[model samples]
Target: MTAVPQERRIVTAIPGPKSQELQARRLSTVAGGVGSVLPVFTARAGGGIIEDIDGNRMIDFGSGIAVTSVGASAEAVVRRASAQLADFTHTCFMVTPYEGYVEVCEALAELTPGDHAKKSALFNSGAEAVENAVKIARSYTKRQAVVVFDHGYHGRTNLTMALTSKNMPYKQGFGPFAPEVYRVPVAYGYRWPTGAENCGPEAAAQAIDQISKQIGAENVAAIIIEPVLGEGGFIEPAKGFLPAIVKFANDNGIVFVADEIQSGFCRTGQWFACEDEGIVPDLITTAKGIAGGLPLAAVTGRAEMMDSVHGGGLGGTYGGNPVACAGALGSIETMKELDLNAAAKKIESIMKTRLTAMQEKYDIIGDIRGRGAMIAIELVKDPVSKTPFPEAAGALAKACHAEGVLVLTCGTYGNVLRFLPPIVIGEDLLNEGLDVIEAAFAGI
Candidate 1:
C-alpha cells in the first residue's frame, strides 16, 4: 500500500456496501466508547488517498490524527521496517539493547531544538512519553505541582488525563486522577477575551499571575503545553506568549516541557512547532509522527534533566522495540531526504490561500489558522456573534465524506475542521481535497 491508486474515486456511498457490513461487525465487537469520525473501512492508505474495502477512494486530510506525515506506508519506512521484521521482531531492549534504539537517540540529539547536550528515552505512546517527562521533571526539580494550559490536551492515561483539559470523552468519569496538576490560561488569539492584540502579553501575565498567586511557582516541577495546542483546537499560542511562560519557568526553576506529540516531525512547517518561536524547552515529548505509522514515542531533553531520573526509572518492557526503532529511523530519513519541513510550508501556502478564500465566502468560517499542513477553520454560527457552530462542522465533515474526501472535526468546542495532509501528497491531489472542501462549504 505504499502507493494508492492516487485519485479520489467514489464507487459507492460513503460507508459503502463492504464498509457497512464491516460497521455492523464493528458494532458487535468494538466497545461503544471507541468511535470513528467516518465509518468507511480502510483497505489501504498511501499518498493522499485512502482506499476503502468497497473500492472507494477518499482524500486523506486527517493523516491518522497527524501521525502519518510520511504516509501510512511510506516506501522507505516499509523497506527498512520490513527488513527489520524479517531479521527479528522484538528483543526487549532492556534485556539486550540494539543499535537502532541508540541511533534514534543520536538522531534526536541532533534534530531536536537546543544545541545543548541532550538525551532521549523512548516509549510506546505519546501518553507514556508525557508521563515519563513529568516524572523526569519531578525527579530533577524535586517539586510536585505540574502546570498546564486551558484547552491543552495531553493524553488519556490517568496522569495525562489529569494534565489534559477536555472533559467529555477524554476525562468524563475518569477521575480520581493524579493530584497537583494546575491549569492556566492560554494565549488563543482568535477567541481572546481582550482581543488578539492583547492576547499575548495579557494572557501570559494572567498565567504567570495565576501560577504565582494560586499554584505558587515553588510547588511546580514543570509547565507542560503543546507548542501549537492540538485536539484543543489547534490554537497557536500568541506571539511572545510561550517565551514569556518559558522565562517564568526558568526564573522559578520549573521545567518547561513542550508536548509536541501532534505538532512535531515537520507537521508544523518546522521540525517542531516550538522551533517556530525559538523557544527551547527543558524537555519535549513526541510520538504521533515519529515512527511512520508504528506506535512509538519519546521524551527528549537536556541531558542533565533526563539523566536525573536514574537507571531503571525510565524504561518499559516494550519501549523502543527494535522494529519500531527501525521505522522511526526510516521516518526520520524520509523527512530529511524529502525535506518535509519545506513540504509542510508548501502545504500551508496552498491551504491558506484556499481556506482564506473559503473564509471570505462563508460567514461560518470565523477563523482560519495554523502553520504548515496542520491547519484548521473555526466554524461559527454567524460572523457577528462568532458563536461556535459544531453542527456546521459536523455537517461539513459528513458532506465531505459523501463526496469522497476524508476530513476531521476537532476543537474544544467541536466546531473546528482540522486538516492534516501527508507531506508526501502531490499538490494536485492536495488542491483536489481542498476543492472537495470548498464544494462541501458551498453545499452548506
Candidate 2:
C-alpha cells in the first residue's frame, strides 16, 4: 500500500478555480440558508487530508466537526459500506428491520461502559438521538421538566433548541421552543461568575440545588449535559463536578443523560467523556464520529431506561439505515485496529506541548485545556484579565486559512480555537497545522 501525504497543498486561492465554479452553482441550486465553514470544495479525502476540487489539498483538523475519527475515508469503512450497498441500502428500519441494525446495537451494548444490561436505539442525527433520549426519560420517569446546562448545544430540533444555550443562529426565529425545559449554569472554570479559581464543583452544586428547589427533582425527567461542552468552547468540567451531578441525579430519580455526541468514540481518548470520571449515565447520546462520516446517532443506556418508551415510539423512518450501520461497524473496527484511544492521547500530548509554547509566546492565549485530541485554546485581550477577544480569534482563524490551514473557532463568545484532527493523522501533518496556527498568532 502507498503511504499518504501529510502537509497541505495549496495550488490556488482557498475557493480554488473549480470550487469557485461550484460555489456559483451551489448559490443557485442549494438552499441559501445552508451555511459553509470553508470555501474549498472537497473532491477527495483520505487519512487526514482533503483534496479540493481544484487540486488543493489541506490537512483536515476539523474531521467534519469530529465525525471522522477513523479518518476521512478509511479503507475498511469504504469497503464495508460498498459491500453493504451491494446487498441493500434502506429497508426503513421501522418498516422492515435488518441484521446490521441489530448487530450495531449489540456492539453498542457491549462497548458502552457498564456491566449492567444495556440497550441502544439508533437515529439519523445527533439531534434525533438527543430528542429520543429526552422522550425516553420522560416516558420512563413520567416527569414533565428537563434541565440542561448553559453553553450546552444539543441540536436544532425544537426540543433540542430548548436544550441548547446559544441564541443567535440555532434559535433566532425557530421558537417557540419545546415546553418544560430549563437552563442552568455549567461549571466553566475560566470565566465563571463566582470568581473561584477552580469552581466547577461549586457551580454544579449550586445549579443542582437551584433546580431541586425550583423544579423539584421528583418532577424533573432528566438532566442533560455534554461531558465536554463542544460548540460552547470545548469546556471540560472540573474534576468533581461530573461525579457530583451523577450522584445527585441517581439519588433524586432524575435521569442523568450524557450527550457524548462530540466527545465519544475515542475522540476524548476514551469511548465516552463520562468514562474519565468513572460515571455511567442512565442515558448516553452519541453521534458525530460513530459512523465514520455517515449520519448515524444512537442513544444507549440502562436497559430498563432505554426500554421505557414503547417499541414503536423509539424509531424513525430511516433510523438505523443498513448502510450507516455497516459504516458504524467498520468505524468501530477501525478505531480498535488503529488504536485511536492511544492516538487521541498522542494528539493531546503534541497539542499541549505546542499550545503551551504558543501561550507562553502570545498574551492573547488565555487558557489551554481539554482531554486527549479534543483540545482548545481560549483567546483574550489580556491573559490576566481573561477578556474574550472574538475579533482576534476570527482574524487568527482567517489568517490560518489564508495560509492553507483549515482551522475552526468556537465558544459562546466565539473566542476559542478548537482542534479536532482525525486520530489517524500523521504527526508531521499535525505539527504543520499547529505551526500554521502559531504563525497566525505570531502575525496577529
Candidate 3:
C-alpha cells in the first residue's frame, strides 16, 4: 500500500478563497439547515489527508463521521466499485438479485459478532437499517413496544426519532414520532445519576427494573443500544452494564439489538464493539464504515429472526445497490489485509499518550475516554466540578480547523471533542493532527 501524506499544508485562511465563494453559493442553493463541520471544501482525499479546493491539505481526524475506515478514496474500494459499475450500477436487489449483494451478505454473516445461524439484509442508510430491525423484531416477537436508551441516536426517520433520545435537530419539529417506542437510561458514567464510579451494573439494573415495571417486558419487542454510544460522547457502557441488559432481554424474551453504526468495521479496535465484552447480540445494525463511504447499511441477525419479516416487508429501492456492495466487499477485504483492528489499537495508544499529556497541561480537558481510535475529550469549565465547557470545545475545534486540521465536536451538551482518525492513518500524519490539537489547547 502507498504511504499517507506526511505534512499539512495551509496556503490560505480556512474557508480559503475557492471554498468561501462555494460556501456563499451553497448557502443559496442548499437549505440553511444543512451544516458544515469545517468550512473548507474538499477537492480530494486519500489516506489521512484531505486536499481542499484552495490547494491546502488538512489532516483528517474525523473520518467522515467514522465512515471511510480504509481511508478516503481507498484504492481497493475505488477499483472494485469502478469494475462493478462497468458491469452494472443497479438492478435493485428486490427486482433482480446479484452476486455482489449475496457476497456482501455472506461476508456480513461470517464476520458479525455472533456465530448463530445468521442471515443479513441490506439497507440504504443507518436509519433504514434501524427501522427495519425494529420491524423484524416486532414481527418475530409479536410485541408493540421497543425500548431504546437515553443519549442513544438511531436516525432521523419518524420511527427512529422515537427511538432516539436527543431533542434538538433530530426530534425538533419532527413531532408525533412513531408510537410503540420507549426510552430508558444509558450507562453514562460521566453524568450518571448514581455517580460515575458507582454507575455500573446497579444503574443498569435500575433502568431494566423501570422498563419491566413501566413498559412491561412482555410488551417490549426489542431493546436496542450502542455498544459504545456514538454521537452521544462515545460513552462506553460500564463493565457489567451491557451483559446485565442482555440478561434482562433474554429473560423477558425481548430481542436484543446492538447498534454498531459508528463503532463497527474496526473503528473500535474490534470488528464490532460488543466483542470487547464478549456479548453476542441478537441483531447487529451496522453502517458508516461498512462500505468505505458508500451509503450501505445492514441488519445481520439470527436466521429465524431475520426470516420473520415477510419477503416484501424489508427492502428499499436502493437497498444493497450493486456498486455499494462491491465497495463493501472491497472495504472488508482491505480491513482484513491491513489488520485494521491492530491499527485502531495503535491509534488508541497514540491518542491516550497525547491526550493524557494534554489533560495534565490543560485543565479545560475534563475527561479523556473511548475505545481504540474512537476517542474523545470532554471539555469542562471546572475539572473538579465537571461542568461542561461548550464554548471551550467550540473554540478549540475552530482553532484546530484554522491551523489546518479537521476535528469534530459531539455530545448531548456539545462539549466533547471527538477523534475518529481512519485506522489506516499514518503515524506521522496522526501525530501532526495531535500536534495541532495540542497547539489549539495551549492557546486556551
Give per-model TM-scores.
0.99, 0.98, 0.98
**Candidate 2 residues 1-444, lDDT tens each?**
243466589889877878989889899989977898887888878777888888788888789999989887888888889899999998898888799999989998888877889999999999999999999999999998999988999999888998999997789998898899988877898887765456867887888888989888899999999999999999988778888888889999999999999999999999888899898989999999999999999999999998788768888788988999999999999999988999999999999999999989899999998898899999999977888999998999888887777788899999999999999998999999998899888898
Residue 344 in candidate 2 has what lDDT?
98
lDDT of 2: 0.89
Residue clash pairs of candidate 2 = none
lDDT of 3 by residue, 325-436 (tens): 9999989999999999999999999999999998998888888899888999999998778888889989999999999989999888899999998888999999989998
Stretches > 4 Å off in candidate 3: 1-6
On the 0 to 100 scale, the lDDT of residue 195 in model 3 is: 78
Q: lDDT: which is higher, 2 or 3?
A: 3
Worst 10 residues of 3 by lDDT: 1-10
Give the CA lDDT, 0 to 100, for residue 155 in model 3.
92
- Cα TM-score of candidate 3: 0.98
lDDT of every model, 2 decimals:
0.93, 0.89, 0.90
Off by over 4 Å in 2: 1-4, 193-198
Off by over 4 Å in 1: none
RMSD of 2: 1.3
lDDT of 1 at 47: 81
